[model samples]
Target: MHDASCRAGLARHGIMISLKRRIADRFHTSRLARSSVVVLLVMLLCLATWATDRRSLHLQLLTYAGSLGFIANSVPVVLLFFMVLVVSRRVIFTSLIVSALMGAVYRINAIKLETLQQPIAFSDVYFLRQVNASVIHLLSHYLSARIFLFAVVSLVILGGMYFWERPLLNLKRLSRIVSALLLALVAFGLYRGVSPARKLYDRNVLRIAPWAPAASELHAGLLGTLVYQAIESSTALREPVDNAAITRLARLEVPDAGAPSPVASQKPDIIVIQSESYFDPSTLAGIDDTSRLLPVLARARLAGSVGQMRVPTFGGGTLRTEFETLTSVPLAAFPKIEFPYLQIHDKTMPSLVRVLKTQGYLAYAVHPNDANFWNRERTFQSMGFDAFYSRKDFPADAPEDGWAIADSSFTEKMEQLLDRESRPVFIMGISMEGHGPYLENPVLDKAMRDSIPVPSTWPENAAKEYRNYAYHIHHADHELGRLWDYLERRKRPYILVFYGDHLPGFSKVYTAAGGFDDHQPASTQMVPWVMVSNLGLKMPGQPIYSWMTGGTILCSFAGQGNDYYAMIQKAQRHQAERRMASLDRETLEGIESLSRLYLRGEAMPGNVKESARQSFCAATGVTNP
Candidate 1:
């Protein structure tokens, strides 16, 4: 028993020695190990700096080396982390794992921001919260190879970190605290001392490249760009509207007794359809099967007006156009508003619906999606619709092939509403059947898919997407015919205003099919708008339309005049672009000043301020008001 105990003691001592050696190696204060960790951090940071800009490797390397002084920027934060390492006496693996993970996230986001051509502005974080599959798909095209690239680089970085995990045993608490504080001061002080950062602020570099954020980011390093955006967030520079300018605009227009939403004399039944991402397929090149694209629209094209509708947002943000057409206010004039519904909650506006109500029409809105998307429920009420019909109100069996109500069913709903109405109806329908994620588009069946011919040179993905979009577009066109045919036979005279909200987000497919010019931005492309009227409703001046002009167009059919309608008529007569480049700064200032006054709680009507409803009713010769 004594001999067994002695052997056990010996084994225990041997295990203790081995454990001590392992701990000593991992937690040693070796000068070389400490220096290696510092070097690794420096290298990783330099790499991150280069990744922030999409520049050639040689130029990026030079930039990295040149900005070595900025290494001080991260040192204090890193030291604070290392101090925690000291307190816990954790293995160097702990420090390396944490730092490297942080570095990977930071660098990856920087790359994405650079690719987006926008800095991490204040709204960007907010946008993240709203991200859905569509947003991911939109970003995926730009980052085709980035995921693989990031994984490879991160693997290499972590591999190196794993080998260099070493602790700083002699790093005393006082010494660590002082070093961290001093390093923080040095970083801030040196950053402040630099003239480059100061110059970025002095010049307002961000404003110089308002459309191209990447240019500003390239000029200013990531940190500098961040600072600039932060400052701008807290204090956005708003162009002041001159009060004197408002009076000058008033002088420019003589009160016309006639113009309806800008000039309607007849109270015709009006139907406006805000089609989701619907466009003329023939507008793109190489669409062999466009024979089925817009048959009814082709026949109706010559009746009223047919041209492009220029919208503010692209791929998404449908409400921007909806608000513009409903109210004669240009979104470009309001820089601060993103989603107007969110901005103007519970606030009444001079909308087309409000105008129609005064004309003794039952104004109603129909959207075959959720009531709360983009907060349409509140916005529709504010716009003066009597009530809203959303997804919940749609038929339970509405979805035939996929989610949401089908366009065919939607047309059925419109017919039912009109039939059931006690008065002439002003129906505004926002269609969702054409909304996308074309990847999951219900296959038009194998037989139909086989009918469409794809270009040989086109990428597989583009071809597939176009085929799917074509299927939906076909359905939309067919349903449109049904609506038009039904309207043609109706006893009441009617006007059908049909327009696409915006071009669909098909990415490279748009260019691949030769539909859009690859050299230009997608937002610059226009969607087709056709007004088919049984009541002689027509746009008098410009063939093209903007959101702010929709109300004016509708009012013209009623022979009504309002402040906005009058302004729109002058713009159309003068063939003025929204840019107002033909006008002098003074004239433009006057125009904007008018917009500010009129848009701020001012609903459009007569030369004198009056209720929008009253002005609309009076224009229609109704003595009720």
Candidate 2:
């Protein structure tokens, strides 16, 4: 009886042991499943950072793998990748799409930034809010056949992942715990000085924007670089902030305000026109084309004064030069700041418009674009313009050039504005027609292509671009004639200021045409500026900085401008008549002082006051802005 009972117990114990084994097999991940996940991760890392630059092709993949590991050691980067996958429902399709976008932007920044002095920053994204055909015209020139290859490879990887992998419907609790612990380790690295994201960026990006732009993609990996940029941008320029600097500037003997009369008292029917990407391509040699790119401008130059306008940016960032021209503020003082409009938001920053308002002039700004672009509608008000006239205000029948309103149509709008004005007009016109991505043009572009000739010495791509650019600026030149004709017919005393914002960013073509070096130096991008005024103005014959352009205009006839412009004019050493780039160390100190006071709302020294209105800060407190 005892032996039978023992046998029953042994059988029950064996059955229990078999059940435990089945449970363990169900939970355990197979070697094939583990390998598949590893493969997917490796593929993603490769595709996200596959660089195509010939210079970078050498050992680029190996470099990217190393860089990815280093970047992933940053807590934020790891968190961002995980969150992206989570947001996409862990579907291979959506996740890969995200990876593809990040990769494409990486290449675009690497290629486009070659001609640019800086890498892709948050400010560049802000500019895209108002992209036009000009933007396309410019972007297409930078693209190569490699981009298609990237797309194909990306698609193939995505397809393979989609077919080979099952939905990550569930992860074991232990697997999730491992992920959390890994992330925690990365975060801990900050204290250990291993993955200090901000420190790494500040040390690298300055050298990168100018020298090794390809590194922006390869060094940190795409998403990793972007995450670091976000952190760096938020905290930048804090290093330069000094209360003592503002105090020292306030103490510097204020240069006798050149504008004894001010932006108001001498408001000489000011007409400032910034033609889009306006430069005389004919100035460059080897282009066999005989005619000047802008005949009207050339004729006007003969009669008036001609000089180069040294803008702060290249190819894009019109607002930078525009802001400089308007406010007489040297970008030099804020060298690290990319876009001031984005940076100085919420502040009623002083401008020529604000200063001109103090005088009896009614300032009206006109642009053939949506008023909201570059946040201009609100920003203009902050600049103190009495009114802004945008596309909505233009004549409905105004023709389009490429993607923008024709320059002639823009002048027509200016004429209409001048026609209705009862008060002295401080009218500023910004033309969109010559604005680029000059690859596509209006219906009229085709008709004029034959009329436009190219240089035999120029590359085929350059010849094509020059043709498109020449055709558009030709109309811009014609419209310049129209504006002057309209002004002359009105018989009004006008101070017409026409200047190019910057050279078009035609990198390869410009280099091939011998117009520029591969290094893309700042001096090679000089643009033309012509001032023709009935006010009997004394203009500079040589080059002047764009920031100083407005001050020279305002102070020309009357030698009168407000405290801010007057102060800037005082800083000019050689071209005292203009706001030249003469901000010597002493001048910079003064400007820096004033910049902090105005843009930052910091107070002037107790003993000193820079202007009648002590503050340029609006009632709104600046935070994110």
Q: What lDDT tens digits, residue by residue, belong to model 2 across residues 1-625?
A: 9999999999999999998877645534465654465356645644444433222335544454544434432334335455444433244554566556655665666665655534576556656765765445445545666777778888898778767755453556666666656766655453233545556654454223323434654555444444555554554445364556545554444334332223333345788998888887755655543346567877876775677777887887888888888877667566545677766676577777776677678898999887777777888888888889998887788888766788877887788878888777888788887765654444365867656777677677677767877787788778877887777776666777888888876655566666533344543567878777655555554466777776676556553455555444444432333444344465567666565555554554553444422322100111110
Clashes of each: 23, 8
The residue ranges of model 1 lying beyond 4 angstroms of the native Cα positions read 1-208, 220-239, 242-266, 287-291, 343-346, 400-403, 514-521, 559-561, 576-593, 602-625
lDDT measured at residue 6 in model 2 versus the true structure, 0 to 100? 95
TM-score of model 1 vs. true structure? 0.70
Model 1 over residues 330-396: C-alpha lDDT tens digits? 6666654556665554477767677677768788899887777677777788888988988788878
Model 2, stretches more than 4 Å misplaced? 1-60, 63-77, 87-98, 114-118, 127-165, 169-225, 236-267, 288-291, 442-447, 516-524, 574-586, 603-625
- C-alpha displacement of 309 in model 2, angstroms? 1.7
